[model samples]
Target: MRNSIKSVFAAIVLSIGLFPLAHADDALDASKLYKAGQLNEAIKKIDAVLAQRPKDAQMRFLKGIILTEQNKPAEAITIFSKLTDDYPELPEPYNNLAVLYASNGQYLKASAALEMAIRTNPTYGTAHENLGDVYAKLASQSYDKALQLDSANSTAKLKLNLVKNLIGNTTGGTNPKTNTSNPAPIASIPNTAMVATPPAKVIEPKPVTPTVTKSTAAINEKDNVLDVVESWAKAWSNQNVSKYLAFYAKDFQTPNGESRNTWSEDRRSRIEGKGKINVRIDAPNISIDSNVATVKFKQFYTSDRLSSTSRKTLVLSKQDGKWLIKQERSGN
Candidate 1:
């Protein structure tokens, strides 16, 4: 599986004209081990190398990849963020950072990172595919946009198909809309994630439009969010390219002045390391107005494989009558 993905990424990169432009100081040995699928060994080798040269951005980036594959995404995020801060000109760190976002259902952050990645290297197919996924997530968030948006966007269409394929593969034979909606009881979540405080003011809500409950609806919007969040967790648990992304309004900002996209993506990857995961969401607080709603839950995590749980807030809205997450943020 690893080799196949590498081969595909390489071919995709070559097809798009990306040269293997590792910096002079980059740790080639670790890269080779990572390319060979020896993730743990690559990590150790890079750790030794970085121990001697802690400031090497390329080495850090390479180590981040290995750690991510090893289900150490939080560490990966730290490494990648450091690489980007230390060497903002490099595109790979941004792309990898996007990967972390994607794996956590933080699509907006994934999209933003891919944009930066593309700005640095137009030929980076990983960024393109990732951006495609982000667009696909946006489409998922707003079906009307799917129909209204340009059909010339082959990338979005392709990514939609890819997401469908991935969901299909992961969900046995059930339709993605159905499979992801089947919510298991909330299990214990990792204690590592922060819990966000929901709006305390009980703003007088508008009349609730009666809709099918959790057990029904051709597409249970709330259930769908649960499933998507579940799938996002599973994707990270499996180290599936760390492209999980959640949607949030561009206007949504955290108390700390962080955008919903940035805050949510940061915590999502922090807790959902790249391994197995057991999860539980606090009693969900859901509110709807017309086709828009907010699904507030404190996602808890266990320490077994995927450790740490952060409080999670997902803002969901309806586009064409389908519920879509537009924003996410976490508080612990």
Candidate 2:
């Protein structure tokens, strides 16, 4: 999470490192303060700049970074959000908002923000990577919770291990537990001769301990489905054709009444060639019935040349231990 946040900050820093928002000297001073790790001083300097140019986008963006560095997440979020509203075409603010949301453990909000970032700039590789990392983080949290609820759940354990392995590979971190020889078992006990004791009565096995409450399991299941849907939306916004297609089953119904192959090609053209696309999913209604799940939501789509709002529903099927979209349609 820190890595994601830092990468976003690095982008902002590099982009505006030499751009002066205030008077030459003051901007220099502020940049110095920021580099010196005097976040409070940097904030003061940037605030002075903002005072002169109230709506200065660069100044506001700088101040937001300073606030975040000062450990003021709420303030930082407000600043970034305002920037996003004021400069809807800029992807940086949305990326910054995602960093703050992830820091606050609001993965859904973070995912949404990153999606918007990619939509605002479909070629923004940073946002795409950050979105992937967010998915990994969400998966990590879910699988970790599953382990906590049921240590004996082999599936959960295996999934968690796989996630950790992915994270480790991405981060290039070594597994500390690897290659460490175990301490030689403290000397094996010597064989001892013992007289046979009288046969004891057979003991009944103890009742199995309940690993998870029904309420907790329900919540986990709901969260897992939500994560998948969020990821699907993110992949679409990012114009990640491969990842987007992977979320659907081979039998997925085409919303445009076209054959699946034609539909896929159409989606690819629209997503990959659109100048900028912003997709937002809101107020999702999810219902589960065994292996089948239904999700309804408001989808807000925008691009450089057009915008629309529509109700959308997705029918998902649990196949091979994963949720895949089996059908989708637009609604009133």
Candidate 3:
């Protein structure tokens, strides 16, 4: 799997070209050294660039890729992590972070990072595909755990074997530790090109009708709905069961078709059982119609024993002038 990831990234880089040549000489020279497999020289060139422009995101990103090729995953992770912090709007750093995490068998963390990547850029196909691979690895772990607890369970055994076969197919059945392939190339750099255009003839303009805009009340309602959703996440993170439950409407639909009271109790137990927990919502997409609103987002969850990321949707409705959750589901 790691080798496949590296191969795909290398292909992407070659196809897309490297960073925009703002500092054309240095950046181009460094990219040339990297492509030549001269990692030591590449690192020195990148370091020299960083020494002058310490916050150059592109150089730092290149350095991270070089570090990964050098088998310095810890250092690479640091670089990518810092990039994500400083440039949360850039999806590439998050994707690279996920790759490093997966290389280390930290699929949960990888999934979370990938979720952030997708949130940053919904059109990023690479991150989306990488996330699927990470999820497969996580499913493999769950199946293995099930077999450990019930060795006699034929179903679990069958699923475990199937997952293992799937993983083996992608990874060439090679142990990650022994697979000494070069790390995947970083293709996150934005490509820039200059094009010359012919002059256009002057044209007359026509008067246009006014565009319709949302009413102030509608805008405020959307804001309120978002506030409610954020508060719910905060409540879950804080383990405030009452507050979390209060965000739901009296007729809230339970995901598993359970009675509302029963569902609340189950949620309470799970929230309180955790030693620590965090729930974050990223890139929330909301649509409002009449009194109802539907919101979809990447939900990242973490606790002492587990971490995961998933796409979640919530249906909210106006109730007594406040937005409350009416229904919830996972995935689109």
Candidate 4:
């Protein structure tokens, strides 16, 4: 059976685009063995090279890939997990981790890993695409559970079928790895008590009119806030450093482990030096309470050489009738 998981794995391998490791010729030899399907020899060669340069990220990455292709997922997971811990700035390992997690039917963990991958490199297109697929899988699980609980429930049945159709359309009906000739339980989600609906009764119309007005106002406010956030994203995408910086409040909290000035300089250089960038937002969830709003969404970013999708959160404070980001975070 054709597997989307394997397809995603192939994309990661292609997207690596990294230079050779310190032991360049040896690493190249190992890579050739891997491509020729001699995983054991590749592993041995890569390990020999790693003995001299244990900290080479590229070699470690290759080893991880070879191990994964060799059906040693647990070992591959260990390598990728350690790489993320040691080199938090690299997005590839996190993306690979998500692939493994998803293959194991751990969609939530996969989603989290993809989020981290995007967080490290917001311009990673592959991660973003995989995240959307993961979300669909999650929705499928939820719908399936509803069907399991109420076998005779027409609404639940209809919803489940609809979700399945959606999943099929989006992912070409690719089954999760948990499904084989004989499938295994993908999750241990417990069933909740389904409340029986009482006979319909007449209610006062007073509650309805005011609720609609309030909802409309809330929606408008949310749209306004989303526009501001979208504009900020656009500025960054366009590589307008000054306009991007302007979106942040004067007292905007700096990123963890970096001084504000240093962070600013780094952001400026990264944005300006990269020739072109494209950023797209998806499924923005915005919550507002008084003068504060929390916005979370998937951020799709692309430059000439890099692309990713990551989860981004913006905490905005309404001041002087304008919304400005006070704090921003990516990933989990």
What TM-score do all the candidates reach, one by one?
A: 0.38, 0.48, 0.53, 0.51
| Clashes (candidate 4) | 8
Each model's RMSD to truth, in Å?
20.7, 18.9, 15.5, 14.5
TM-score of 1: 0.38
Candidate 1 overall Cα lDDT vs. reference? 0.53
Candidate 3, residues 162-218, lDDT tens digits: the string is 766655543322123322233323343331110112124447799898655668667
- The numbered model that scores best in TM-score is 3
| Candidate 4 residue lDDT tens string, 195-227 | 112225557666553455888988988988988
The number of clashing residue pairs in model 1 is: 41
Give the Cα error of residue 185 in candidate 3, in Å. 11
Clashing pairs in 2: none
What ranges in model 2 sit over 4 Å off? 1-26, 168-332
Which residue window of length 10 is worst by lDDT in model 3? 190-199
Cα lDDT of all candidates, in order?
0.53, 0.69, 0.71, 0.69
Instruction: For residues 1-332, write the lDDT of model 1, one tens digit per residue.
Output: 00001101111122222224443324455555655667678678877876876765545655665566566768878877776655444566777676666566666887777776665555666567557655655555453345348777676566656655433221121111111122121121111011112223568889997876654663465556655554554444334434444333345455577766677677676655544444445566766555666667777665454457677777766665445557667873
Q: Least lDDT summed over 10 consecutive residues: which range in candidate 2?
A: 186-195
> Which regions of candidate 4 are displaced past 4 Å?
1-3, 6-22, 168-332
Runs in model 1 with CA error above 4 Å?
Answer: 1-28, 35-38, 144-332
